[model samples]
Target: MRFATAEIDGAEVCGVIEEPFFHPFEDGVDLLEVLRSGELVAAGKRAVSRAGMPLDSVRLRAPLRPPTIRDFVAFEEHVEGVARAVSGTGVAPEWYAAPTFYFTNPYAIAGPFDEVARPPGCRVLDFELEVAAVVGRGGHDLGPERAPEHIAGYTILNDWSARDLQSAEMKVGLGPAKGKDFASTLGPSLVTADELEPYRDADGFLRLEMRVAVNGEVIGRDLLSNMGWPFEDLLAYASRGAEVRPGDVLGSGTCGNGGCLAELWGRPDRADPPALEPGDEVEMTVEGIGTLRNRVVEGAELPPVRPATARPRDRER
Candidate 1:
């Protein structure tokens, strides 16, 4: 069942399913409580609703705060293009030896359908569709074969990038931080790995259907299994000699040939670029997980909060 966390009346709450099939499990489940339980929330233990509120109405929060760690561009094509676009080269052999990443401020995470204002200094904003894995248990230095056991569930991650800023920092060999970390959006809800099993394809790829629409026009589409660097390898490699814990998120990087800018806009080191404007709305979706829709407004003020009493907690029957 899919679960979501939202803020109503200044208190953030976990949403569980009261029933199933209205987009998987619309029952309200508490994410933090479920992770800490060490066992899946027993079926019939929570409530769900299909006729629930529209995703646009709720105040979304990060699915998990203080996500253990964040990984970057794992897809060879996306990385190859990014490198050639900036440095005029292809994949670095060093990247394949071990997984790599940058630490994002977990506090900066916003929620699905929230309004994302353009950062004051950024004229170019981009959206990336990545499958994020949430750790269910903690472990360190685990081998690739044993990696799947540490997974908790999956959620949509928008690794929003500031292209102009990112291009400038890579010259120093130590960035994508100021460019990437400014605001990373996660959620709608965290769906346990067990729930994703049914969507798996014969090729061993999770058949998590995904699409991105800009201003109601479709811009991106692909299946989750097409990823070259699967989540299992990222987990195993990332935890090698390091500790990974529950509530941490690992991004699958932007899908190869699936990104609007990374693939469609250019061919190999030679093409024009698209810049995000003040009123553009970028919406990314993964079937079963739900949609993350955000509008680009002038980087000005954060949206106001909605009242608590107005949002009633629906419980499972």
Candidate 2:
């Protein structure tokens, strides 16, 4: 079942997307509530037929708010490419030994069809196509053997970045913060992990086709099988020395040769960077996860920046 959280008439409610129609759940709100109550299908069905409710009239919001954690993992090519961009040579060995990431504020998360404002100081805006796993159960020092137990489902993530800010911050060893903290887009819906369990092969690699488009132009494509470390390993590694909890989201980084500006555009000396300008629309899609669409607006008047508030979950051993 595809689950989501949305706002209808100023109230937030959980929901299930059934094609052109959306079935909104009750006041409990959020994917965690639906999963914990085992009422996904029942509540979804009721919302579709209830009085004063219009399945086609409500607006969709990020499927979850206050996600316990948000992890960016899964793309090896992106890691190598990004690392290369930073070092001007080869990747470090340590990046492979552990699953590393920066935390994002789930409260600031946006949804499909929302307008994403470019930050005031940013001149280069880029979009990344990724799949993130959602945590269903909380765990500490989780082993690879028990990784699957903690997974609840999956969804798409648009790791919007300001190339200028990210480049400057990385040099200081702590950043990409102001660049990334501005906004993050997630949703369409969460596809439960159970429904996708069959897609994993014997080698434990997931097989999903991904494609990304900017203003209706295709720019990136790859298979989930290409990820050097699968979601299970990421979960295991992330939980090693830390804690993980329900409603957390672990992103599959930018896919193979699939990120904007960072991978497709040529080097700094040869050509101009591929960056988003005002009015550019970005749409990202994964096989099971639905399409995530956002329009870009100028950042001439962005408000004072706020850092991500969610704390890090314990990493897996």
Please count the clashing residue pairs in each candidate, in the order shown: 18, 12
- Please identify model 2 stretches exceeding 4 Å from their true place: 35-55, 266-273, 300-317
Please give me the total number of clashing residue pairs in predicted model 1: 18
- Summarize candidate 2's per-residue lDDT along 114-182 as a digit string, tens digits: 999998789878888888888777789988789987787888888888888888877888766778887
Judging by lDDT against the true structure, name the best candidate.
2
The window of 10 residues in a row where model 1 has the poorest summed lDDT is 18-27
Residue-wise C-alpha lDDT for candidate 1, range 88-170, written one tens digit per residue: 67788987866677777777787887777776567777888787888888789987678778887889888888787777767
